[model samples]
Target: MNLHVIDTGFFKLDGGAMFGVVPKSLWNKRHPADENNMCTWAMRCLLIEDGDKLVLIDTGMGDKQSEKFFSFYYLQDTITLEQSLAKKGFHPDDITDVVLTHLHFDHCGGAVSLNASKGNFYPTFKNATYWSNSHHWEWAMYPNAREKASFLKDNFECLESSGQLKHLDVSDWIGNGPFPWMNILFVNGHTDKQMIPIIKYKEKQIVFTADLLPSIHHIPVAWVMAYDTRPLITLEERQRFLPEAVSNEYYLFLEHDAHHEMCTLKDSEKGVVLDKTLSLDEL
Candidate 1:
């Protein structure tokens, strides 16, 4: 099996929103913000080459949105998804599977693209089967007022329209491998049924910490994001997952961390903290 770190690009978000109720003095020391109080973050995706299957974890925010929409997020250091795939010696057509952590615009935007000539939206990965659990799919489709803005229809509706969307059954596995060599950890705090992939690789368990743990700074129990629907549930999820990650010595693959690529957990007097940081190649 082979894993590739597909860096789609970077974007800036309000530091306050990212760190929730945590004081700026605290999180600012770790993830220093700019004059605008915005912190830069990476839209890092993962590509898995396991035998015949080529699975992509998430697609960063795409270029289909209007300039007005993008101005709000301050998207920068941009790299197109297609360009990133080409760098890996592959193309959108090469992907066999796409596992979206959730339907948030930044995470799944690149999953679909505009067919400009046709005046319609279409799946970017023409031959790939897009995977999203039914619960999250429904949540995204009929989004609540708070999250409605993030669930862009153009980013995901095309998958279902193209007859390529597949839903995973959450009950099939508790903590076991659900997709060949990867296990699915269903989390609800960030959004209903956000799926985090726990991949078994080379004698180590590498977990894709989607939005549950956006960056190393988020390893602390109280650093939950303000964007989460249920902050308390996110706290409970982190408390439960971190200890297990520490015990198993799992390598956490961060999705939104701008500088850090990956890190292992260590049990400290305070709680579980980052052990060591390394890139995916170092794994």
Candidate 2:
């Protein structure tokens, strides 16, 4: 099995929103903000090459949105999904599975794209079976008022329209075996049924952190994001995930962290903290 970090460039979002309830003085030290108070974050995705299955996790924000939308997020240095995959010696057509952590715009937008001529929406990975949970699929389709804007129809529709949308129920196992190498963990604080993929690689367990732990700075229990629907539930979720991470020495693959990519957790006086910072290559 091979894992590669797919860089889809960066975008800017309000720092305050990213770090919910945490004071600027605290989070600012970790993720410094720009003059406009927006912080630049990497849309880092992961490509898992296991045998003939090339799985891409969480496509970054695609370039299909209007200029007005891009202006809000300050999308820049976008390395398209196609370009990033080609760099790994694979084309979009070569991808066999796309495991989406969630259906947020930034995470799943790149799953679909405008045609070459910008005429209509299409699946970026034409041959991959796009994987999304049944719960998340319903949540995105009938989004609540708070998250409605984030659930863009173009992003979700393209997957099904391409005849490759495979809704993974709560019990779908990869390769259909008693002991699955790839296991899915579900968390609800960030959004309903956000699936985190836990991969057994090199006799080690590496978890794709997704939004549950956006960056190393978010390892602390109280550093939960403001975007979480239920902040208290988020606290509980973190408590559950942190100890397992520390005990198992799990490598966290961050999605929105600008600098640090992968990190391990350790118990600190204050609480759980980052043990060491490294990239995926180090693993």
TM-score of each prediction:
0.97, 0.95
lDDT of 2 by residue, 1-283 (tens): 8998998989998999988888999889988999999999989999988878888889999888999998999998668767887888888889888899999999999998787586888888878888887889989999999999899998877687678888776667555522267888889999999988888999988899899999888888888888888878889999999999999989888988889889898998877888899989888
Cα lDDT of candidate 2 equals: 0.87
- Candidate 1 lDDT over 1-283, as tens digits, reads 9999998889999999999999999999999999999999999999999988999999999999999998988888467789999999998999999999999999999999997888899899999999888999999999999999999998998799799998886876555333668889999999999999999899899999999999999999999999999999999999999999989889999999999999999988998988999999998
Please report the TM-score between candidate 1 and the true structure.
0.97
lDDT of 1 at 263: 95
Candidate 2: count the clashes.
Answer: 1
lDDT of each: 0.92, 0.87
Which pairs clash inside model 1? none
Stretches of candidate 1 above 4 Å error? 173-178
Among the numbered candidates, top lDDT falls to 1
TM-score of 2: 0.95
